[model samples]
Target: MDPVRRTPVVVTSALLTLLLTVLIVNLIQPVDAARAERTTAAGASSTSTVSVRRFPKAHHPSKSASSSSATKNQTKQQKPDPAATSAHPVDWLKPSQQVDYPDPAAHPGLSLEVSLQDQRVYVRDGSELLYTMYASTGMDDSTPRGSFRIQNERGDHFYNPREGMGARYYTSFLNHGVFLFHSVPTDSKGGYIKEEADMLGIRPGSHGCIRLTVPDARWIMQSVPTGTPVLVK
Candidate 1:
């Protein structure tokens, strides 16, 4: 009610107002700073999420892509060297030539007919005449006639026991692989005896065995099985 009391009260009121104002400002500033930080963090998170969603992810190959890759790999594997293929050609004609022989009609026997008069041999699978080739039978009608069975065979350069001569592709139709059909006799060193090559099939020349060209001898060794019938006439 007095002037002094009123002044002190007014001062106290003013100070209280100032302090409240300061406290409110401090609280408001912290709240605004926190709001700004939260907004910035929210913006960064949104940008990160958008970037992740926009970018593409790695994927597996589709069916078409896989098929293309497989085709490329197969092409790489199957392409052969042209030079190598040209240099070493596979023999495709031999099998075609062999097809000339008629099927045996389930017969078990294969036969060889040695014609001393013609100086030739006829190959037969059962009743079918498959092939024929020249030969040199024994000198002086010494070839064995009638039927015989192939007992043994050999394919190597071997020396004849009597003359110490070498021969190739020896095949035995009689006398247990000793008396034989073989390539024209060679020297001891496996050199060809040209005189014997000239005499082949023109006249009888062997001691007691049949003689043939090297190819024919090898054919008989490979195609003619053991126990095949042989007939000389």
Candidate 2:
């Protein structure tokens, strides 16, 4: 028998290619798994951020704005009364000696009477008395007692050289321009002399003029006209 020959085994191209393809697929599978894990982690982080940002905080008014609103509401609630803004008319008959006057249209209309003894002045409309007020007349019988008409109505105030003081609302008498119905003595600049206000209606305290309260003097200047009858007794 001839010597038996051993056959040599050889790798074919198709088998080698199949072996390489299987090895490449095994390596790529691990890379794909790692990429998928990273993608899932990024998706989870993005979803968490979106969830936190979805709802916003509520708004509140600032401190100054709240304070201003409160002030406005308080002003509306505590508004001042309209009647308080207007002054009430003076009550002229509060004194016990007042006698109500007749209708304002009576003939021989409004007149004035000055009583030195009583230290009072009276306003009359025709035969009826209208109002009476305490007064300060001349000291030492200096205020002349006689009937006289107002000759002139001067300024709201004037200067008196003899008294070295000022007077307001001069309603001059016809007998002598020096004598008049006026307010209590004041300074040269028309400021009230508080000392003179204290002496009013208590006794005779003027040089010669009839001294009245400031309001009474102003009322006479406004209402009483020149040429009105005045009787001083």
Clashing pairs in 1: none
Candidate 1 has a TM-score of 0.53
- Among all candidates shown, the one with the greatest lDDT: 1
Q: Which stretches of candidate 1 lie above 4 Å from their native place?
A: 1-107
Task: Provide the lDDT at 203 for model 2.
Answer: 78
Each model's C-alpha lDDT? 0.75, 0.74
Tell me the lDDT of model 1 at 187: 87
Candidate 1 Cα deviation (angstroms), residue 132: 0.6
- True-structure RMSD, every candidate: 14.6, 14.6
* Candidate 2 residue lDDT tens string, 110-199: 888999987778888767778876688999999998989877656687887767798877778755568888877788777877777556
* Model 2: lDDT of residue 129: 71
lDDT of 1 by residue, 80-197 (tens): 9676564222121122134444333444666889999877788787777777766778898788788988776667668865686777878888878767878777888888677776
* Clashing residue pairs, backbone N/CA/C < 3 A, model 2: none
